[model samples]
Target chain A: MQTEEEFKDFILNGHLHYIPNVSIDCAIFGYHEQTLKLMLIRHRNMSSWSLPGGHIKRSETLVEAASRNVRMHTGLDNLFLQQFKTFGDPNRIQFNKFDKEKWFEITGLTSWEGNWLMDHTISVGFYAVTDFSETVLQTDISIAECAWFDIGSLPPLEFDHSEMVKEALHTMRLHLYHYPIGLNMLPEKFTLSEIHALYETLLGKKLDVSNFPKKLIALGLLNKLTEKRSIGAHRSPHLYSFDREKYTLALKEGLVLS
Target chain B: MQTEEEFKDFILNGHLHYIPNVSIDCAIFGYHEQTLKLMLIRHRNMSSWSLPGGHIKRSETLVEAASRNVRMHTGLDNLFLQQFKTFGDPNRIQFNKFDKEKWFEITGLTSWEGNWLMDHTISVGFYAVTDFSETVLQTDISIAECAWFDIGSLPPLEFDHSEMVKEALHTMRLHLYHYPIGLNMLPEKFTLSEIHALYETLLGKKLDVSNFPKKLIALGLLNKLTEKRSIGAHRSPHLYSFDREKYTLALKEGLVLS
Candidate 1:
């Protein structure tokens, strides 16, 4: 929503268009220059940061809703998205923290007891990996600010979002062994050291040099180009690029990389 | 629900106690004696079979709701449950197939257009693995029958359940590589051939003999016992058992078993 009236109407009548008590929260992981970061947003009415999320529309699929939320925040489309988990603890949201009087002024409602937005909500968690350098973070009227935080040093998030981020990172790291990634995070032709660094950064650990790349090559997800990059005297390394066909197939049908 | 009045109340006022527009569906896979099967339920008012599922109570978490549903149908508890995926296609449910007149008679409502149970629902799919031989199938007032069907010869399921089963199996097989399983499906101290058969049955394919077990042993998940099982004359096999601590730890902190 972009206006006060729109936001008010959403609070009052959004159930007609959107599914009530269900939302989609995304953990957008950004990778650039071997640095891992996460996208977090602060609502205009909230004090703490949260994963960018919105209710799923009646006409949209879950992934479509997640993709829309991700695109709205990052200004990037078609990133690799995966649903990591769903959170549905009854006490997940602290309703006592809600500013009832503040919301009543905007919504013009005396009591918000039966409001559609006040019910127990279960959020579907989706994680996406993208290159942070290419993203132009945008904020709507509801969002006060949008920024990237280092994954290792995230602020205390609101509600159950901290657990969501932990689970998202765990699932993403596990997926690194089964799915082909780094297509959008790396250059068209990159050296083994570059890809190894990407894995090390994402996995948050040091891997044996060339061991991960060898598994990718054996899986036919990577192609070792004959051309070599010139860095220094007798220091050129062979360039490698992802086999798009095999990479796409591996994404659909998973494979074990280790 | 076991009574007609309870069912009617659930149809009309379930949202008071259950979250609306969100449901939980479970694909309960049963493994026993080198055979794999799936649990399917048939509603009393429906003609086809579907995965055993129910609405999440307002007080319960997602996994708790899933566990309740699985227990209601299988007479078992504390199975290995995993949330495979959340399915939310707009057209996933065929509303036109609804027996509106029959429901109206049961609900004593003139028009059922805005009923809590008739709205667009997004289902969270969870899958659990258990030994079929131990479960006693059950059916409530709404469910006409519940039975275990062989995995290879499943009947055409209703709604998006066929797709749900496919995704559930795909995810369960992928999980076998990352998480240790077969705890409930195997004997306490069994031979390598017994565990090998369990893996093959669950994966629906052949695995390299001694290769998979070797990985498990190296990971400290399996322990070799001095005791051996003797079958025929001079033919004996070493007994092995899972290290419960390591297996539980591996289940929480996933490891690459391949």
Candidate 2:
């Protein structure tokens, strides 16, 4: 935990050194238990949730700022990130008088932070894929909690975060149809059914289970491992891992997973 | 042309009402004579060229500002446009000391306009496809000329405009492979070879000419017209137009042109 003085210094002046009016928001998605989930943080003072995001430093690229935000929230780095869109609706930062007063009361931040938050901000939206179980959640000083929610059911989000999430899902679906993406979301040596489940959740529809493995194998992107795992009262299923060389080639060649 | 005072007013106080620090740049692509081209404007006082772009209005979306910029240069409205990326390097608006002095000399823009121009500007990039022969060139007062240069060869561009163009072309190619394009770049009725040329130029590679038409026809996107286009010493090729209904369906269903 940071001291009050340190927190004030970080929030009030830390961002002052960075580029003003430009920010980055990340939709860091993880897949587990046959469901798609997004990481969100609840503000310490407010009940609404928001995606992990921060201002871009003067020396870094927009994408670098997004990566930094991901690390700050999840304690993970080098995730597979892609820039999907830039949201610059001028009214995005507008707040009603009541809302402004409520924010001041909750945050105990006077004019400086209030004006900084209300600036007409332009945010670049990026989406990242990572293994759900691998990340260590780290809530920032201003966040009450950090958690992952099923994309199908999310809490009321702050600002235009809901719109940003919708756009990220749209971009992910488009990419899934044309690219090999499950590798980033799954653990090593996973069964064929696991990979299929990941795709089904991402596409929001069921794919032919029997044909899914065939299509993926045809792309020559997976290596069937010698080891197998047995379920109770059932025969063993073989484990599989991505053949990095072939997977890289398939990404460039454009694999049609659907 | 407006007087110098009006020009300065338009550049300075005219845009001051809009949101600060955010701008829009467009790569207006057109197809003509079996070549893909991009619209560029030469600054009145500089040798370097740049895309037709403008600052976002306080009331408009980023895309809306891009459309306005396209119309300002081409004298055409409602062109098919797609937002590709946003360029937000902090050093983007930074000009060398010599260039700054030179700009003040040439444009007679003192502190206000100069500061506005040098403000750390973040620009959203959009690409629009239009028929080359249909546009009327309209050069703004600050522009020496507005013209189209073949995508294969372009002049020296200003700031990070060259990087923006490269990104736009990359996005266009990626979109071309997964979507039904070229409708905006071609005339209402066009020969199969003409459409093929457009795709080949955009993709930067020659596709099998015989197989290209078969793929497009297979998608049911082309409506066979009763007319034919003539070529000397060869049989006239049949003309075709996009079947709007089927084309819209294919767009949703994902047409893989590759």
For TM-score, the strongest prediction is: 1
What TM-score do all the candidates reach, one by one?
A: 0.98, 0.85
Kindly list the per-residue Cα lDDT of model 1 for residues A25-53, writing each as its tens digit: 99999999999999999988888899999
Tens-place lDDT per residue, model 2, B1-258, is 246666566555654556666778899998876777899988666667888787777778888888888988888887768888888876875455224454555457665443655566788899998888888988867678899888878998888999999989877777776677767777889888888888887778878874566678887888899998888668898999998887777665555565
- Cα error, residue A36 of model 1, in Å, equals 0.6
What lDDT tens digits, residue by residue, belong to model 2 across residues A1-258?
A: 245555556555654567666788999998877777899987666667888887787777887888888888888887767788898887885455224454445447766444545566788999988878878899866668899988888998888889999888877777776667777688888889888888888778877874566677887778889999897677789999998888778665555564
Encode model 1's per-residue lDDT on B70-131: one tens digit a residue: 99998899888999999998989887665567777888999877788878899999999998
lDDT of 2 at B107: 53
Q: What is the lDDT of residue A77 in candidate 1?
A: 89
